[model samples]
Target: MTDQPEPGGRPDAPRLTTREAAELLGVKPETVYAYVSRGQLGSVRAAGGRGSTFDADEVRALARRSGRREPSPAGGDLVFRTGGDLVFRTGITLIEQDRYYFRGVDATELARNHSYEEVAEWLWTGELRPGVRFTAPSETLAAARRTVGALPAHSGSTDRLRVAVTAAAATDPLRFDLSPGAVLSSARSLIPTLVGALPVLGPTEADGGSLARGLWPRLTARPADAPALAVLDAALALLIDHDLAASTLAARVAASARAHPYAVVSAGLGVLEGPLHGAASGLAHRMLQEAVDRGSAVPVVADHLRTGRPVPGLGHRLYRGEDPRARTLFALLEDVPQAAGALAAAREVVATTARHAPLHANIDLALAVLSVSCGMAAEAGETVFAVSRTAGWIAHALEEYGERPLRIRPSGQYTGPRPAQPLPHAP
Candidate 1:
């Protein structure tokens, strides 16, 4: 069989050193030798037979099958994996050395320098339109608002957003146009529509305003100061994409089946409701709020441990150090005078939790600080995440639509009872 060509379309790729192969496979060098011995891997003798070199593609394949590979350091390969065994080659986002990039540019830098709409446009297309703005069409916005208004009075923001997506899809005559241009159009509109459907808490901004400005009124009654708006916009851009998150994987799966851009977003929103994925910020918000209310983080931290709940917002599995998103947002939050009390509570919680295990604050905790300080509801972060991540879902859909249809369907490794056992009679 012909070897699948490398990512650059090269047939003769360079081999990997034993140490490099071991790093990719997440095993020790000795384990690499063991795999070679068991015929599970192939290696070539180095110049004097003093070392071994393995096929680069073979090592990567084993990493995928075993579903384990350590996060590469900065200056390493752009690709990294987490969340599951299935892997898709993507050019969208890369996280390495605790920093993430969008389309190969530093994401945090993009957030700092550009607007959310501008960064999202660059993610979908390589070109950056410096002053790009996304506006929801009146018809689509109307449809979404009608659907959202019909929801039960106590519906959370995510629930309303999900329902709004369906409504927006129905209003769009071209939603099934999955071509690149058409998908980008849908994405540009859908994001703003999702933001628009939420009930406004104060005087509304023009629908054509910057997305962060448009979103501010929906999230809270308090008027947004410039610093607070800066934090919100940065949060939106920072969250535009994280490679192959659970929601993003769901979006890719739908796109693999040729689902329209709206349907793809719906699939992602479906997965976003889970506590582990999107609700995490809401949990962190409540914790920070409690700590602020009680004037100390000690009892709040103790309460979580006493009740068998891990302290929220303290750790992230992906980052061994402080979460970069958290670090960036915390730095920005320092400029917001009103954020002082909640920001202090967040730092106290981190210091308190570090006594037992040294865990760094994740994005959820930073979002919690923003929400608690700004007087936004507990779920405001979720709303921000869902809206920002719609751009990522569309980016993934564009990639998936280019591949062979249904290519993402993985075969099940069935472990159930053997087939055709005698049927049991009714009990």
Candidate 2:
């Protein structure tokens, strides 16, 4: 009467029949088959013409990851996969038809029409405040500066920033408050603190003005100019957020666990080190610098291809055309007279790489042009990226804090030996 295997048969075997697998996973048999077709779960056909069987352990693991227990009030699962990416419901930003938006407004337009602070304020709340300035608290800034100053002399900007944020967190009594007002207050102070903690390399002191103006001196020794500062401001605004990036996902995970806003940012900063994320701009900066030195992008492009490393600063997974951020920044770079040579080098690199594959420039390449022209270090782009994206990470944290606590957990697939195997006696 039961669906179990016949008596004397291996009913409790590691391989399970389709019905047994479905029961364990809490999904319909059809859904289990869908998982197989998607390669999310593997199945083996029984001997001769019998039905397919699945690994019992694998099925349980999938069940734990899927976590598809109850239907929503509308009779559908709250979370579902689309094209192999987890989609989170958010009202903050949207990318559609190759163009991205912030709260339904074109992001590039927002960057162009408003200051970075104004744009960040809009992202945090629906209202926009013109000429807004995020001033750091005296005690927080002093603590961050003291901690950053204590780092090694050759420490990168990102390293100093990480230490600064940790120190700032320790000095704030209300850092644990998750309310919107408190979080926004912390964000305003934290952004300035991160910028203020950096060593000033330029004549333009970070005393008063827009955040971009404050950041300009820290990135380069050159004095700030209108056109150059414009590009930097737009770059900051454009880099604010890209829907659920690797670092943003990490930040969201931390926020879901009720970690303080500072901890969420620290989590994001930890994941921003690798080539695929924040450091990509630094790589692109090096490439552009080499291209300028050689007076041509041909050798640089050839070297990258010969070495089997995909050319950096070109192509984006999300866009079929040129990255919008890159396009905007490139347009802005045209206004900076000092950036002319670097801009030309960037365009040449695009043309050179296009012969092998039709790929367009991404934000990293545009950032490279700026850094190379402004006499900034290669890691300058990484610093700008980190400072610009903190607003976004905090925005995501705000959203995650409102969600169900600890909802981002996903089970890992186990590929080790069977559970009943004897333990090893020696190393």
Candidate 3:
């Protein structure tokens, strides 16, 4: 083993043995020997610690080689070149069937037993309480469009939303040098505000800033039947927090890059807007609605299956059974009959016809039920889910505040033909 005096008279970095390396890499210890034999890893002797040790570079290389692509689950793929696993859960929680890792509390318990602000406080600020601070919706685009007339039509919805929030946060000195407590509070306030402000602004629940209520008119043919607000609020509470999602991961990735609040949130929003990620559920819900309207869920399911596509809202990559979110949301939808029937029929069709399939009915299905029940047009469900998932994005940002800057480097999988001579003849 190669050895030198500790760098700059400082103690040497702790090194791993073949066994230690495997544990650290979440692989068999033999994997270390294989790497060393293949010239992909190095070994060293520890002076200050264990004498038999593996090189840090070798360990990091192994980790990148076996990242999320491996068959391991959420808690498994954790080997890296830098930083300890700071995000491990102390316990799992579920409230109103919504899942959370609250030191040790169940999320369903927290959501059903606690208010939206309480859950927000718990996830972001490390504290929970009833009736947490909430922001008012925007007054800029109130029901009465007061700019004398509609503005020009070229502005994109996504751009308008991002720029508006960025501008709003920029005007506030508080966002800079933000305290964890402050960020959490701002998140609590900004979510509904974003929802309310998306179309207009500065109204609270008392002032009737129910996001679903406000956005309903824009999506549906008629005004909502009132229970929609309850379903939407429940959604905001239930879907607001989770360990990590792809979009949330992207948000955290931006945060790890030390991006400011707007950039981080925008990063998350961008990812969530992707069809394969966070926004998928909302889209799934719309598809379910279409299937239900066809009076038979099986035909819709069959069409998707024939096309080698998935029937959304029925399955999840993580949750094995019905997604806790779907259960929680469906329970909440009991009061909203229109949503409840649609939800039930969708579940039945998926279960009865798609038995061999993985149609587990996730949060998207729940959101769909709530949206239709609330008079939301099928198209707007995805947008609302985006609004809600951003809460989790902010919470992840807060968690990353103490982490080292993002050093997530994935190596290329060199698989193409390495050398290419000139083509002999054009065919």
Candidate 4:
């Protein structure tokens, strides 16, 4: 056998063995032969003519050309998998060991003591500053209120919020500024404006205090107590960020295009309105209400299970055992006297579902329980989720703004027929 040239070839224009060529090109030896067959890469006869060798220059050239092609998965989807494992990376929030952490801080722990405003500041600035206030200007709140009031009386909370955000953006003179400081300011203002603009049942004692207190009257006619307020605060803190959820991804994609913060939020709200996303909580609320009214969860849960449809708020795709958010919020519910029926229904539903399959109550179930117990509207759970998740959407938008613009663009695989020749144009 002829001796092979050194790796990277000799200074005198060396030849590479087929194996060496394949290694350099990150392909199998068979692929190297295929390239030779296609005339894309050249091969030379060995000294004894028993095996083939590749010219070093030709292999390197082919490698360079291959690197220029866009990287994509087979069948032209962005779906990436290895060994039947699907993976994506984000430095924001992590779901692991049946718990969630935001930038290394335990989310449940944060929810225990922190308010939603403090959590939002933490997620946005990577610092847990206590007593952080998210305040909207008086004029901005007035504009949002005007816009929301103009909507039809039957508009859902999410619809009113969507239009309110647009109106607030239109009124802000600094909205076009995309600087980090400006964006953060806008996010802080936007959250408060969105919550404050909602129609309330009665006057709130502390209108500008905690976010939960401000939002209480809007969600329910019942008065806000410390325990109920704590549950709402904790729910908001826990739901502040959850890795890159679909709505957050949509917000990030919009931010990647340099869209204004309002536009980014609008994009997120658009996706959150879907049934499978943020609206799942509303369905869960209705299901919980049925059990509460009937005084038994077995019949409701059993009927849903028999249909082969997933029981809303019972299972989660990420957590294996109990969802930590649900556990935290439900634990708080024990102190809420009004939530007795809803809490009982939730427990029974969880117990019954676990017997049939490995399912546990998730955050939606907790939100539903909170809503029903507190006399909130049937769709109040979705409102909580949307309002809470807006913090995460803003955090993601800020993160995306710092990345390479338009990096989220995905190429589509054309599956259409070949193009036909155009007919001659009339003179």
Candidate 5:
């Protein structure tokens, strides 16, 4: 077969390869295909029909149009629930039969043996190399402490955490490296630094311990007993990843743009501050506290139902029966004296709710109970959640980094009024 000029191509028209077109548009090759599929740009078969070539002028025109204004569909027809459909694919974690599996290993089972660091390393590198450790550099920890300590005493933990992460990113000279090893190193350092820098109720010991044990003193003045520490460790493992949570999606989007690991974590943390996400645990904590004070779980649940608000710790959209994470944690608390009151209240709430509906306790509710049992503050549950889920965010960010860049951009649907025509002025 002989080569020929592209059909309808000008004799001197410039052509661009797929990679060149992607560069011009600041998109991935998959996105370029998306543009072609949507008829936003044109392409022709290459010489000998080997591959496709794009018209440089056409590609440039599309870029200019995109730059001028955001593109939108004709009508506001496209809609997807926040957790409804599978918008993207992931190999990190999966939700099946009301249980979560990380890389095909049962998370609840893994929690029985692995620490948060092991689970995090498994998620990041796809290997569960035993004896692997994650430690923050002395300088990074010092920087984080200085940054967090400067925050106002009344500042929320999340706000202080945000500032600390920003400072950590600014101090790391290798923040721009996007390679896998570099990204993993940054995540390892960032997690430990963040935990160590937070304000603590007591002095933290220098002795080597699990991540949960190290974080215990920071969350409350409660003694770091083995049972309590184990519960916290299991919670951390279970919350490591939940398959494309809102915060995870935000992190992935940031990573798609090649943002540094710290910046990607910051993005995830920003989304997690919302009540519907990370703060759900705080609401559950308050409810449990009220139940304990009132000496009855029925009244508290009844009041919540009467107020037309969903019980904070019960009912999950994805799980039909019960959250396995909640079940695992609740079971662990059954024999602990410190958690006795909180556990009793939780049971009563569960029994009362089951009479009226099919609702069951979720991970947030379990975390709340754990926080109260350990005598932590009302907002302490959210802190645990944010810290634990940082592992998942980093895992998802790494996954997105390996995929096509900028493939998460969503098309908008315009519903606003059309542009107005100019009117002639009278003299």
Candidate 6:
């Protein structure tokens, strides 16, 4: 019934019978049916008959297939293709999305209604109805604490997290197993470990909250946020997860290869450590700070774009519209009271750049400006990015656990002649 003739198009799309199509394409009638099932062609049932009819255009299109492709260079470009459907997914914190779906629950609503503990529990296990703040069995809190506590009290949170996670995985039996239960347990354990080690609230410190404040004795100058505990809680809640990203992809790749939590998570963090990705916001913020400090953000903003370097933090790759995370943080910024100047500079920066490039302040840029203006460290922003992406990494790792143990197989084009010529060597 889809055969509405293209206005003045080929004679009513000549309803060639399957047998006729086979003749036209130089194949058997069964081969014509094979093409239809393989999605290589289309067909419609003949009017008032059991036989299917083929549009002449589709038949001709099939006839044109020469089974040849462009000669692409040997190392194929990396691409993402949905591999297959999965049954179970687990233990991922999500990014600072406006509509963050944490394990299946809506994060924006949860961010407003539930506590971080509530969300963390939900992320670990699907039970959303709140009860106790505790996570599931084989609870690794004491073990994680002991491992981190052994480090010198002066260690930075990032350093501590790295060491702690590495140490925790060494003893965890689940890291070697590709089982979902084990991976899930490791994910649950690592979350607390990372959060526990962040820097204490204090001056010269960009990140501090109750979690951080608890470790303040390590820093020479501790900041005084009267409700230190609240900040930590907020940090836990604020950073948790995000969508699939390059770093997340790296993590997933490692997991798909059956790497342990430490190895897999490290793979992701290593990618995120790249300046072009995770460090983007902090770099942008610092760039803006230099401009502002020199009383030249306006001029620099204009000149930078002209010189080929677009203003950092104002544009995004996917969000052609305003970045939702930026909008949410903008709302959060309204209440911070002390971020007025940075907010003003950011506003001017955003307006100035829009005249040239299609960029919006993504989460990193927004968080950078707000955090810096609110007296956070420049490095703290990227650290938070790592924490947020951890959510998605775990989720992806869990998804991979159910699939066949795979080392991504690809066909390499034969470019080098069978074997290299033997060279005569005089030793």
Which predicted model would earn the best TM-score?
Answer: 2
C-alpha lDDT score of every prediction, in listed order? 0.88, 0.89, 0.60, 0.83, 0.82, 0.59
Clashing pairs in 1: none
Going through the candidates in the order shown, the clash numbers are 0, 0, 26, 0, 0, 15
Quote the positional error of residue 116 for candidate 1 in Å: 0.4
Model 2 agreement with the true structure over 1-427: per-residue lDDT tens digits: 2122333434455898889888767668998788887767777668884888877666766776764332235733334444446768888889977789999999999999899999999999978999899898889999999999999898988899999999999999889999999999999999999999999898865466899999999999989899999999999999999998999989998999999999999999999987789999999999999999999999999999999988899999889999999999999999999999999999999999999999999999999999999999999999999999999999999988888788776656567886898877987
lDDT tens per residue, model 3, 50-92: 5456655456556666542222345333323334332332122
- Global local distance difference test of model 1: 0.88
Candidate 5 least-lDDT 10 residues:
75-84
**Deviating ranges (above 4 Å) for candidate 6:** 1-107, 129-160, 177-181, 198-239, 291-296, 410-420, 423-427
Shift in Å, residue 214, candidate 1:
0.6
Tens-digit per-residue lDDT, 1-427, candidate 5: 1223435667667888889888777778889878877767777777787667788877766765564222224422121222225355578888888878889889888887888889888888878877666687888888989989988899888987888898889889999998888988888888888888888896577846678878899899867888888899888888888887899889988998888899999999999999999989999999999998899999999998999988889888889988998999998887577899998998899999899998899988899889988889888888888888898998888878887677555545445666785675999
lDDT of 4 by residue, 1-427 (tens): 2334434544567778888888777778989888877767766678888788777776766765564122233423222333333333456898898999988899999899889999888888898888877888899999999999998999999999899899889988888798989999899899989999999885687556988888888998877888999999999899988887789888988988999999999999999999998899888898899998888999999889889777889888889999999999989999988888999999899888888787898999999999989888878888888889988988888877776677665434445765885776989
Order the candidates by TM-score, highest first — what do you get?
2, 4, 1, 5, 3, 6
Local accuracy of candidate 1 as per-residue lDDT tens digits, 1-427: 1122224423466788889898777779999888877766776677776787778877776775665544345423323445565566789999899999999999999999999999999999989998899989999999999999999999999999989999999999999999999999889888989998999997786556899999999998999899999999999999989998999999998998999999999999999999998899999999999999999999999999889999989777778999989999999999999999999999999999899889999999999999999999999999999999999999999988887687564434456898799988998
Which residue runs does candidate 4 get wrong by more than 4 Å? 1-89, 421-427
lDDT of 5 at 219: 91
Residue 370 in model 1: shift from native, Å?
0.9
**Two-way lDDT contest, 4 vs 6, winner:** 4
Preferred candidate (lDDT higher): 2 or 5: 2
Candidate 4: residue 355 lDDT (0-100): 87
RMSD of each: 7.4, 5.4, 6.8, 6.5, 8.7, 10.9
Q: How many clashes does the backbone of model 5 have?
A: 0
Tens digit of lDDT per residue, candidate 6, span 1-427? 2323334336566678878788767678988778777766777766796788877766755564522121113423222122222112234544343345666666655644555555655665666645333231233445555677788867644555666667667667667876667776677657555655444454433332233333332322335443332333344455555655677767767876787767888888778777788778777778667665766568878778678876788766555666666665666566555566676777778787777666677766666665566455676667666665565566677765554445333334445755767975999
Query: What is the TM-score of each predicted model, taking all chains together?
Result: 0.82, 0.87, 0.73, 0.82, 0.80, 0.64
What is the model-wide C-alpha lDDT for candidate 6?
A: 0.59
- Residue 250 of model 2 has an lDDT of 93
